[model samples]
Target: MILKYIVERNNKYKTIREVLKNEFKISSRLLTKLRSNKKVLLNGFSTYFDKEINFNDIVEVYLNYEEDNSNIVPNNIPLDIIYEDESFIVINKPAGIAIHPSCLHYDNSLSNGVKYYFDKIGLKKKIRPVNRLDKDTSGLVIFAKNEYIQECLVRQMNSALFYKEYMAIVNGILEQKSGVIDVSIARKENSIIERCVSNDGENAVTLYEVLKSFDNLSLLKCILKTGRTHQIRVHCKFIGHPIIGDTLYGTKSDIISRQALHAYKVKFIHPLYNNTVEFCAPLPDDFRKIIENEI
Candidate 1:
């Protein structure tokens, strides 16, 4: 992707570097990279940052680059594409598959699939998952097409404008219809993946509203004020109503094979458009069945 900047009259930018750093918000590392690769174009010709830019000067920064993604072996898995653009790609991930490859999920991971898709389309950009959900959790996931888009979206994380909402089912109905869980969460000692409520941990906040209730279960619409690892599951456990079938943080259940949590929705500013965009995934069959009392 080429970031085009037209120098306006009475612009504060004095040089190509200034336009890139100040106007485009280009990080120092990326600027250095562009400089080294001669990726900056001044009026359609490769130019150095030291060049003086005058009014009506067009500066274009090239962001499309082929990368080495050999670590992740590509798999021919189908992607549930939600939205796609030059800046980013949105995917609705299903439960049981991870976002990236690891020792346990080496080839079947979502990144592996994305790599295959990228190869087919001849897009050599790196696979960058902008947000995260657990392996058992299903929902909307975004993969940035380039570094600039990644930086923009990542900066919005944990902020109000980068809204995220999840649908969760808990073991019991809450006495209160809606409330906030503001607390600190820390990794449990001697465990690699477990998180617990602690005063010494990082701050995490969750806002929840009861969406529906049936047969000892309460479906909740949970909005995250802060994104922490296993935040909603941990907070629900902290409140003595852990998410149903969350074997790691709560008891496993027969109603659903995996944790009854789905990343229902996400809303954020599109870095390329400078406008708000939202994406939502319908409740998966397992979640819907439970809500309909099929279990």
Candidate 2:
């Protein structure tokens, strides 16, 4: 893929490196590549990183390197593709499926399935997930086609430019119709699998609106201001309304076996397209049935 940049008249950058690093937000490692052997064009001619760029200078960065996918074994696991384009793909991942390969799970992950799909379609780009969901949580997961796009999306994620919305069924009704939960979360001292609200942890924020209420359950629309491990579940527990079926932070449910949390929607500005895009995954059968029969 090629990333094009045009120097504006009022820009303060004096060198190509400054423009690449500050304007285009290219990493130092990639800058080294540009300085050594990678292709960089200035005004339609091959140029060096130290070249002086003037007003209206046109710069193009060519990244055509092949990625190594030897670690991720391709498998024929079925995938539900929600959205796809030249730069990225969004999949409606099902519950109980791990997003990436781990020690316990080798070949049955969503990455394996994506590798298989890419190979079947003769695509050569490596599978790089910009965002991941828990193994037991179902919802839309985004994957970038190449490293540059992945880096761009990661910057956006760090700046909280991405908007992710979730649907969760909690154990009880909330007194307030809508509110924000601002707290810090950290890993437990002796437990690697558990997280708790703590002052020494990273700041986590969640905004929720009660969508529907029942005698013993409430459906909520949750927006994540900051993404943290078990942020939603821990915050719900901190507020005394843990999600249904979340045994780690809340009580188990007879209706479901895993946490009743689903990443239903995501909105972001496409780095390549420069347009706002949104994708939504329809509620899975288990989640829908719970709301239909119980709530």
The Cα local distance difference test for each model comes to: 0.91, 0.89
Pick out the ten consecutive residues of candidate 1 with the lowest summed lDDT: 64-73
TM values, all candidates? 0.97, 0.93
Best candidate (score: TM-score):
1
Q: In order, how many clashes per candidate?
A: 0, 0
> Candidate 2 regions off by >4 Å?
7-12, 34-37, 43-45, 54-57
Q: State the lDDT of candidate 1 residue by residue for 70-122, as single tens digits.
A: 77788999999999999989999999999989897689889999999998998
Candidate 2 lDDT, 1-295, residue by residue in tens: 7888898988788988887888778888767766575578898888878889888999888776565777889999988999888788999999999999987778989999999988887777788999979989999999998777888998888777899999999988789989999999999899989999999999999999998887678999999999999999999999999999999998888899999999999988998888999999999988898888754
- lDDT for 181 (candidate 2): 99
In candidate 2, the residue pairs with backbone N, CA or C atoms under 3 Å apart (3 or more residues apart, or in different chains) clash, namely none
